[model samples]
Target: MEEEITFTVPIRPDMELEVTRVASSVAEAMRLGKDKIDEIKLALIEACLNAFEHSKSKEKKVHIKIKMTDDRLEIIVRDYGVGFDPSKVKEPKIEEKLKSPRKRGWGLKIMRSLMDSVVINSHKGGTKIIMTKRR
Candidate 1:
């Protein structure tokens, strides 16, 4: 059977940590390794930070849904805010990033690197990021 947990958090400083704590608990219960758990937490942090910083939602909140099974875990982070075109986001080069003063646009890349799969659906209404990790 699948287990699901859902909650909403206001966009504020350190709110991402609350979400990460829950993720850690669920991942631990799922028997994910320490390294995998750390990766999930980091990916989740990036997702939450992105929503907090960029969503521009009137609600000023982020919604999270976690689905877990014996062999897989899926985390969905959503925000009801103005969305942007993912295609337009430029991929940052490490070399340029090191030289640049502003070094903030790596959330998507980090999430993708840590999770098994990352899917983003964004339109004018909002954005939803579905990240999965397989055991």
Candidate 2:
């Protein structure tokens, strides 16, 4: 059997916590391991924060969808904002980050590292991130 939950949140402060609460409940219900649930929560936070800080969405909202099966979980995070080119983003290097004043830009890398799979779809209108993990 497959189960799904969908929700939308405004691009406001602390909204990511609300999303994480829902995610935690769903993951617990699915009996996901603690480490896996933590990873999911962290990745979801990064995705939501990116939308909140960078999406520049006129609607100022983020959309999330989670699909769960017997042995798999899939999450989608989306924002209707000015999209960015992933290819154009430079890979963050530790040395450069240490030297640079801005200590950010690790969201994509972190999400990919934590999730079993991550696919990004971004155009001029919006960006969508699809991430999955297997039990």
Candidate 3:
């Protein structure tokens, strides 16, 4: 996390492509394997999706940071959205989520399963989700 790759994009559905693009660029520059690249991209997608789906800023913007090192890849997804209580995003059971009416809320769970580390910070100003995958 000493040096970071960063991007700032509108927290909107249309900006999801930019999320993939930013992550993919870092993945390729690091020579990540295909599987890792996909995983990283998906991780970023989940993060961006969370922001896009939840943030309420007038401009609808989110900021992201990616840091890679010999040991792992660290990603930070932050959104200026309506904040939520991180303590309460109960891990969605896949089976339950599949059967539920909401049919969503799986992003956090998926990200947690794929990344070695997952951390969420939220306040009135914004929400931040941080994930790291071991290399």
Candidate 4:
């Protein structure tokens, strides 16, 4: 069953729930389990938070697109923000990260862990995080 969904919403925090709903609807359509659903929701929320924090002050919305099939799930989280280099992201050792007093770089790490693949493409136009989870 191959299917796709795409839509955009405001970058404001108020639109967070809308992102979650979009994810949940996709999960249900795919018959995903609770844990898998939660992972998807978390990934979306993290991406949305990033967009809300970093996107252009003049931008009106963030784009989210998802594709699902029997063998895998794919999601694209896009923001019209000043893009950053994903290559510069480095993960702290598990122990160090776990023991650190403050949160940092955890979002990128979490997204990587929960999904089998994550590719971030960012430029002046926008930042798009493409992620996949093999079922």
Residues 80-120, model 4: lDDT tens digits:
77877777767657788678886466678788887778888
Clashing pairs in 3: 11-60, 55-81
Among these predicted structures, which one has the highest lDDT?
1
lDDT of all the models against the reference? 0.95, 0.93, 0.81, 0.80
lDDT of prediction 4: 0.80
Native-to-model Cα distance after best TM-score fit, residue 115 in candidate 4, in Å: 1.2
- Model 1 lDDT tens row, 16-66: 999999999999999999999999999999999999999998999999999
Q: In model 1, which regions exceed 4 Å deviation?
A: none
Structural RMSD, model 2: 0.8
Q: Single out the weakest 10-residue window by summed lDDT for candidate 2.
A: 85-94
lDDT value for model 1: 0.95
Name the weakest run of 10 consecutive residues (lDDT summed) in model 3.
10-19
Off by over 4 Å in 3: none
Q: Model 3: how far is 134 from its true place, Å?
A: 1.8
